[model samples]
Target: MAKIKKGDLVQVITGAKQDRGGDRGKQGTVLEVLKDSDRVVVEGVNFVTKHTRVGQSARGSREGGIETVEAPIHISNVALVDPETKKPTRVGHRVEQVEKDGVTKTVRVRYAKKSGKDL
Candidate 1:
């Protein structure tokens, strides 16, 4: 899985939307992650128009109709937002040891490079 997790706030670094001055420096929450393809869908980012015939789905929501939904953006195109600085930052992995009932174990933790805060 990618370092970025669902619900993480991320800002687009490079994309057509960024070039257009709409989502360039804007930050949004990650709705989903496509691990196999290393892609992520951010809330209110990379919107695409879908034209579907009028119909309802089992979910009760209309399945067929023109709707705009967030599209997947490559993982490299976005960076996680640092909570401390409130700016986009690269993710870094650090190993830490934790004491358990009998022994200590090593675990990997992700943090922002800029602020060095745990994610």
Candidate 2:
């Protein structure tokens, strides 16, 4: 499994709209992981319009028309952002020791390659 996970910060790397302009280099956190489909839904990215019909619950809702919602983008298209540098970076894993109750245990952790800091 990839070290990347939900809540990890990421920036888009490729795509027509992504390459063209605004928010292309913007960073956001991963909201959900669609591992079966090899896709991830990033917060505030790949927005699409959705049309909804009037329902009993939303009878008087004026904002029931076409609504734009963020769509899922492929996980491969995004690079994880390093917390230290606050810039996009690739993810790698390493084992680190932590002490608890006078005992040490190795735990997998993420580190920022750019800043050489543990994330």
* lDDT value, residue 26 of candidate 2: 58
| lDDT values, one for every candidate | 0.84, 0.78
Q: If scored against the real structure, what TM-score would every candidate get? A: 0.81, 0.77
**Per-residue lDDT of candidate 1, residues 5-24 (tens digit):** 99999988775555565677
Give the C-alpha lDDT of model 2: 0.78
Residue pairs clashing in model 1 are none
**Candidate 1 wrongly placed segments (more than 4 Å):** 16-21, 59-63, 100-103, 115-119
Residue 70 lDDT (model 1): 90
**Poorest stretch of ten by lDDT in candidate 2:** 110-119
Misplaced by over 4 Å in model 2 are: 17-23, 56-63, 115-119
